[model samples]
Target: MATQVNPPRGMRDFLPVEKRVRDRVLRVIRAAYEHHGFEEIETPVVEDAARLHAGLGGDNEKLAFAVMRRGLEVDDLRAAAAPLELADLGLRFDLTVPLARFIATHRSSLPPVFRAIQIAPVWRAERPQRGRYRQFMQCDIDIAGEPGITAELELLAATGDALTRLGIPDAFIRINDRRILFAALDHAGIAPELHEAALITVDKLDKIGPAGVAAELAERGVDGERLLATLEAIRAGESTGAGGTLHGFDAAALEPVRELLAANAGIRLEFDPTLVRGMGYYTGPIFEIAHPDLPFSIGGGGRYDGMVGRFLGRELPAVGISLGFERLVDLVSLPEEEAGETVALLVDKEVEPTRAIAIKRDLVAAGQTVRMQRRTKNVTALLEQLAASGATHFAFVRPGDTAATLEVKPID
Candidate 1:
């Protein structure tokens, strides 16, 4: 008996039609990024385990697909008591970490402010569900060496434009600042040490609701009431009547981002006091792309001013936004007819093979998707094959005295 073969769990095999849809979506995304002056770049799918464990990826660090040391165990591993000691490299869980390493190594050769577009697959060891996979594609755009809020604005605009191009309607951006979050925690009497615990809880507000998040925070030894009060105070500050500053929350820090969002058409930007994305590297502004039809954010990213500096030995402010390519493909279905019109050339075996090849080349050069096949004895079988090929217009060809003449007709 032969062993059965299958794709690994949480992975998929994309057939021709499925691949076409993915490619079309990616083309739209790439065009949007390129139009905004972002140059495309690629990084390796794997990275040093140390870089992945560098505390920048937040929860994604735990989900990294680690690769074991190939030949010999290091001295650390030879005497180690744990299996994790054997890992020297790991598959990248996200594009940002590798981008940081890329920038650190290539800084002198690159421009001062670099806008990059990276579209690639990343691996994670997570449970697979609809719109979630262990091996998935991330479409990322980042700006390095930009410390101002304009980076955030441009990221949001380009991302929003991409979604719009993909025919996603009623898209909105939920905006927040890490500075505001920390201040709210402080005003709520949460100690510096407990801020992370509280932030993690608050990040689940949409998933579990306000009461659920508060209950979870209390279980984690947080003062839930004070935290809720602090959140309210921050929201109050954003309102029309509140004073310039409340509870040390700097509303001014977000004013520029807010103004930019307001001016952009088709963008419904709102101040989300609870939008604490799990990534610890976010130093300033944070945002999530929201749609009316979905309960979860389709995409998110924020300012990670300290991430690249972890490698570069100096402060390098950067901001990035990621489009959830897989999730978007799930939400937006491409029409079957949009794939392309396939043209099938049924060539008689008696016809000169060179003529058939030449016709195929000509049709291909003219941008028609042409597939050449030898004529079968049964007309019905030939039609079946053409139908299976998804050929919209099929033709029967015979080498004439002068040229190959085609009797073309609709597939139907």
Candidate 2:
């Protein structure tokens, strides 16, 4: 009996149709990131265990795919042990941490306020469910060395614009400042010391509702009155009096954010009070984008001002966002069959290599995705299979022909 081969749990193999849609999503995002002056960069999928540990915070430590080396002596340890620590140098969890390390290592070569875009895979050791995966790609854009709110706003606007251009016009970019969230917690009678617990609870507001959140808070030692106050404060309507008097930092502190949102006339922008992102590195304005039809966020990111400093020993303010490519694919209706035209190349056994190449090139140049008929079937059989596979056009090439004739037919 033969054993069946399968992809590792929580990982997936994208079929041709799925790959097309995923590629489309990536192309649109890459174009958008480049338009915003973000230079593209690549980072190693594996890093030194020490650097990975220092850059990715505590929660991620458990998820590191640690590696060990064998078959090498202490004298031969240098050569043999090089690849052994693949586990120690776990797969990157996200692009931001790697970007920070890249900038710090290449500080002299990079410009002040460096802008970069990275598209790569990240791994998480969480249980897999409907939309979540253990390994997935994240499209990220980050800017370092600018601490102003305007920088944050620009990222928000760019993110909104990218989604809008991708046909998710109804998507909302929910924005919130960590400072504002803290201020609201302080007002609710939760002491600054318990703020992290309060944030973890409040973040679940959408998932479990107010009662569930309150229960969670109570478990963390929050008093009933204080928990209710916190919920009500966050649920309070948008502030009207410049900075609404919840926290000492008046509307003036929030004006830059407010103004930026107001300027974006097309996209739906909202100041969400409960948007406490799960990551620990975020220090300033944080945000997540949601679509009316999608149950999960399509993308999110925030300011991590101290990350660069962790490596470079100097504060370099940065903010960025990532687009969930797979989630976006889920939201879009598959392309209409009629809208997609595929060309099938039917080659005779005696066809010369040069002529076959020319025919394929011509069809591809005419904006068609070409698939060469395999030797598994005769020409007639290949043609029948191509028709069944949704190919609308076909080209038959004979040996030594200067121009291959295309027998175009539309499939119903």
Top candidate when judged by TM-score against the true structure: 1
Report the Cα lDDT for candidate 2.
0.73
| Global lDDT scores for all candidate models | 0.83, 0.73
State the lDDT of candidate 1 residue by residue for 133-212, as single tens digits.
Answer: 89999999999998876777788778878988888868788888887788778777788999888898898887888789
lDDT of candidate 2 over 205-258, digit per residue (tens): 889987888888888887634655653554463555334655542434355456
TM-score of 1: 0.87
TM-score list, all predictions: 0.87, 0.82
Which stretch of 10 consecutive residues in model 1 shows the poorest summed lDDT? 399-408
State the local distance difference test value for candidate 1: 0.83
Local error of candidate 2 at 330, Å?
1.6
Give the poorly placed runs of model 2, Cα more than 4 Å off. Answer: 55-58, 69-87, 234-237, 240-243, 247-259, 262-266, 333-343, 347-370, 374-392, 396-412
What is the clash count of model 2?
7
